[model samples]
Target: MIRDLLHNKKRLSLPKGTGILFAMMFLMAPVQIVAQDTPRVTSKIDSTHIRIGEQVQFEISVEADTTTLVVFPEGQTFAPLEMVRASDIDTFRNKDRMNLIRTYALTQFDSGHYTLPRQKIIVNNKELYTDSLQVLVNDIAVDTTTQKMYDIKPLAEVSRNYSDWVRYLIWGIVFLAVAGALIYWFFLRKKPLTQEEKEALLPPFDRALLGLKQLEESRYLIQSQYKEYYSELTNIVRAYLEEEVHISAMESTTEELVAKLEMMQQAGKLNLEKDTITNFKSVLQKADLVKFARSRPDTHGAEEDRKVIENVVVRTKEAIPEPTEEELLQREEYIAEMARKKRKKKRITTIIIAAAVLVVALGGAVTYYGFTKVKDTVFGHPTRELLHGEWVNSEYGYPAIVLETPQVLKRTAIELPESLKQVISTNQTFTYGGLLGDFHISASVTTFREGVEFNMEDAIQGSVKTMEQQGAKNIIVKQDEFTTPSGKKGIKVHGSMDITLPGTEKSEKGEYIILNFNEKGAFQQVIIIHRQDDRYAKDIENRIVNSIDFKNQ
Candidate 1:
């Protein structure tokens, strides 16, 4: 009956309670499925309270399926609290599920109560949030009653390490070696000699004999190179005659050479036998025929011609006359002059090379180290010396002002006019250097009579007027409020000015800073002046300004 009614789309009546229960079961089923798929995110801190500047570790954890991508928060997401560091995300896996945890180190400098905002975590493109945390930062307690206070110590000098300069020294050595090699190769090294040069240096007769020996040992005869052999043989005898007899034998034809020899014999210049002359002429004509006319001579014939040529050279050398004493002396002087010229040339070359090397080394130094650094190192700068020198920390004047300076300040007597003595009780001054020097510092304290109120504006105007009276011109004035490290407030008057040197018309751009403070019925002033565009001077001024302190009476 129930199946027939349900199949026929008939409304089957049931108890009201049963109908409501069925409806509730269907709605809860979908909710359970979604709850199972959602990722879980939680956060906690190591401590709820910490001292100021103490670190707290805050961690966030997420559990999700392996296929889900989880991203944790980054950067300074915690306001009023600083993130000291962030650790890498750690992953733990269990079958198809994974857990990711990330830790952040957080701290706060000020003592206060703070709340860490909820951090956002993303899982599979869905946003998830962790719970907010509350933290309290407590200040550290100090027992100032029993603690003793000491004067601020002077700045300790830091010794520079010279190890860094070793690199420059090594580079200098490399450059010097390169320069030396170039000089030696171009100016000092000696080269080897060629075969022709070696022969030319020998005596003419000896050179001719050597050439004939070389020709005999050559392969020309074995290869049936008759033309080359005969040509070389004739050249040997021609070279000997040209050098020994001072004749143009190499350029002359065989007929011309023979005619010239006969003329010299007739003129009594050469005592030559007819047989020697005939043998030289016959060999030359045969060599010319072999060279120009393609005439071939047998190896035996060529060997005989070489023997004749050697004999002729010997006879010609014997016929030449010996040089006289005057000629020998003149030859010696010529050789001496040539040697002197060669030495002078070498000296000039050496000087030029040395200059170039010096220039290169200097340029390298200027390139590596700045020009200003090299210049200051070579020619000392006063301000640079003061900046690197030992410094002094001292107190000066009543209600004493404490500061550090490169040099000790000297006390100078201050004279108050009798007319103004009734209004001013005492004036004390301390100074270092002068207005026109590279750097100057002056501090003064002036006590007033009873019921005299000190005016800082008037004092600033007076100081500026006094500077102008002392040859400061084109002054530009600027004013600003300044507070010392000890919380002493004062007015800082500073500007640029043109200062004329004493007894000179030249002016230099200068910078000055005046700090004025009035305390305990006394007016105190600290003035600093330095040349403009001086980096070391600027550093000194900054150091002195920063070190100024007022001691409580």
Candidate 2:
């Protein structure tokens, strides 16, 4: 009976609600099929374990329809792991469907076990998540017991970089070229003479004659240029009268000039012939008419006027009296004074130009390299030279203080007074420069007599007091423990102060460092003093302090 009931499903009776559920299920079947066709996202890593600071590749793959838009994970979304780099999305297509794969380089600097959080991806407005991944970062292994130790390497000499100096050198060459050109133009160079200059060099009488001859050869009269012809003719005669007769003929009117010449003849200053003066006046009037009233003269009339002007010049030249001996000497003196003034003017001009070039060159250098560098380059800085110069490394004094310095320190005798002779045995000093100088370095070693204990604190105090005695005022003191490169420990006393040099009341800001060490009942001190703002001096102080070491007895 059960088998008949199972086989005869069409005959079996169903409830009313069950039929509605079946209809609902039949309608949702297509929706489920479409949901299954949605985009799929998956993620994987190349390795689950990596050394610290090492990179691991993480890949994300998405499968979607060609029409679907997909967005892969981006940025630092992976917690506990840093993304080093993200690669471009790679796509593979098969008919209507496509696969997109994006790779990310990830790294972790720390050693730990971490889980890469699930990454979010979007496809066609639907959100999807990739499965979380496990990662392990292991520390690099080291066995220090088997490793060998080595001494710290000494400072290697750094070759100076001349690339920056190349520009300065080019500027220097340009400046030299400009200076040479100016000097040659103002002083050494022989310039070709202009026409006017060549004319001025001739004597006044000869110059006027040359002008008349040149005008006679000119085309002014032939070209109906009557104004030019007459103008030149009159100028020649007027210039001759002015130079020979000592009258202002060129600037005076024709009437004023004739009147002056007649008065001079009456006074016996000039022995001019009345007929010569009359002819000179007539030629000047005709030239003025041609110039102002547009009066034209025939070529033959202009030629006759030129002849009269030439005759008048000759008569005026003959009438002029010879100068006395005193007058001749005065004229020579005047010419010499004028020549001196001309030379003085040239020298002044040359000096001004040279100074201008120097200022410009210095300004350019300061603008590019800075004022400090330019000043040091031109004038020289002692500290700067010592900073870059070859250094000396040697041991000094007993109980051997070994260090390096810019220059080898010279040994100096320190005489102890009779009062302290009983307490101190031997004191040796090596020094360069002094307290008042720009930079100073000194090393002193003093061995106390038997049964004496060296006290570092007392030594520091005594050193400060000594600086005060040497014109240092307003001193600030700071103390610290210092360790040398060779593992010797010492007391470092450093501070700033104002130093007044002897013979001058002005005080300059200064900085100082004093390093004191005690070994085998002997006290050793290294003292450095320099201008407060000297960077090179500070570097030198640092290098020397770092290089200090005690030699074994």
Candidate 3:
């Protein structure tokens, strides 16, 4: 029955498009009652005894739900006691009600006993009263002869210095300019080759001939520079073979090239005479010996080998066929396309690297200022939005319990037995949550006979019974004493319960904390229910409980 009521309430309260979730319920009403027990008001002072002119905090707190408006007794209400300053009204929400507290700093000039008359507060257009409180003001004893006096001292000005950030600003601008220039050069700038630069490009055959002519003009052969001569001689022939025959001749050893040429001849791919092949092998083998073993050759032998290499190159070119017009055109087009792709790939790579570096630098700047906000920006929290959203802090129910929450609790109707209702003068129940949310909270304030004290054991027992009625089973309850910041004591019952909703065999895990505070004839109860596994909801729960204020002096 309770579960069904909660579902109905959530269906009406939640926004459109929200799926049916079985987690929230609220009693909706705006009730105003004017019975003798409607609002419980209390006034207390920080100290009953104080020296003359010494200030004391006088606190008046009223507990009721949002259905009623509570106006505190302000102005010079204390005749003998002078009112110094009235504090801003501090409101607390507890479950379905509000606890409104207003404090006044009072001091008296003359030393004497003072009787604070009962203060009247208007609640929902009805007058409610708090009992008169007492305070004592005594004159402080003064011994003029024993007291020492000190002479006044002159004031001196102190120098102050502030750090300059102009240097950092200038450096930042310089860095940005350099980065921009680099990005432009790598990704955007384009420079075409001049006509002179294009003329510098040489065909493979012409380059090889030019290299041989340069080597012959040098004095390497006459100076017994056999190593240099052999190195240059082999390089020119290897370069010519690679470009014309498409062989990796520059990277191959002499023996490997000879074997490869023999295989190509056997495959009828190339026409090479045995003598020419032998001549090529001899030149390469002699070059390796001179370069690695410091072997020297006579000038006559070097000249003869050079002429033999020249003849070999001429014969090889004669054996090679020239490209047709179509093949030449296709080769030029393929080379141009490849060059374009290389440039495009290089530009894309440069942009990606530059953007990555910029993001890293910006992230560092953000992290240096604030870690939490930056962390949230990168990795968001599940409940951060709700925790930081707008909140309401107000008084609710009789014997008002004050609290603050993300949203206002709605008042719900409660049916009580005739006997229990007679003893319970004012009973207000307010609740929040009945949607697909992680937390649920309820607050209730009940007032009994003015002199009767509420029992802690009975309250805990009543709470356990209520949870059982709501489909809780296998309940494990732990009890502890709690004291609010204002020094009011209460009983806290907390633990886990296995709750199965109506008509469901599967049970969901839930945890709850119930705090019950009673003073005079007023009882304030606050209960929070949350998913056991949600640590974020647990943090919120702790924050709510820690903010409890009883308004005690």
TM-scores, one per candidate: 0.53, 0.54, 0.48
lDDT of 2 by residue, 208-309 (tens): 878888988999987999887877777787787787787898899989998999999999888878888887788888889999999988888888888887
lDDT of 2: 0.85
Give the clash count for model 1: 0
Which residue pairs does candidate 1 place in steric collision? none
| Top candidate (lDDT) | 1
Rank the models by TM-score, top first: 2, 1, 3
CA deviation > 4 Å runs, candidate 3: 1-225, 248-295, 298-322, 325-400, 404-430, 434-437, 447-460, 501-504, 519-521, 536-538, 551-553
Query: In model 2, which regions exceed 4 Å deviation?
Result: 1-185, 188-192, 266-274, 343-391, 412-429, 433-439, 444-477, 481-491, 497-510, 516-524, 531-536, 546-553
- In candidate 2, residue 506 scores what lDDT? 90
Q: For model 3, where is the 10-residue window of minimal lDDT?
A: 19-28
In terms of TM-score, the best-performing candidate is 2
Better by TM-score, candidate 3 or 1: 1
User: Candidate 1 lDDT, tens digit per residue, 250-276?
Assistant: 999999999989998888778888899
Query: Taking the candidates one at a time, how many backbone clashes does each contain?
Result: 0, 0, 25
Better candidate by lDDT, 2 or 3: 2
Per-residue lDDT over 1-553 for candidate 3, one digit per residue giving the tens place of the 0 to 100 score: 5466456765667565342333332233354776444578888888989998899998999988757788887788876688899999998987777889999898887677887778889999989888887888898987868987668764344442212234546777887788878877766687676864543477777777777787889999878889889988998898888887778898999898888878876776667787888998888787898899998878888888887788778777776656789989999999999999999998788778778877877788687956665555446654554465555687777546778776677887789889776667778998888422467888888878565656868877988898888778888999899987667789899999887865769878888899988764578889998777764677678777876754221
C-alpha lDDT score of every prediction, in listed order: 0.86, 0.85, 0.77
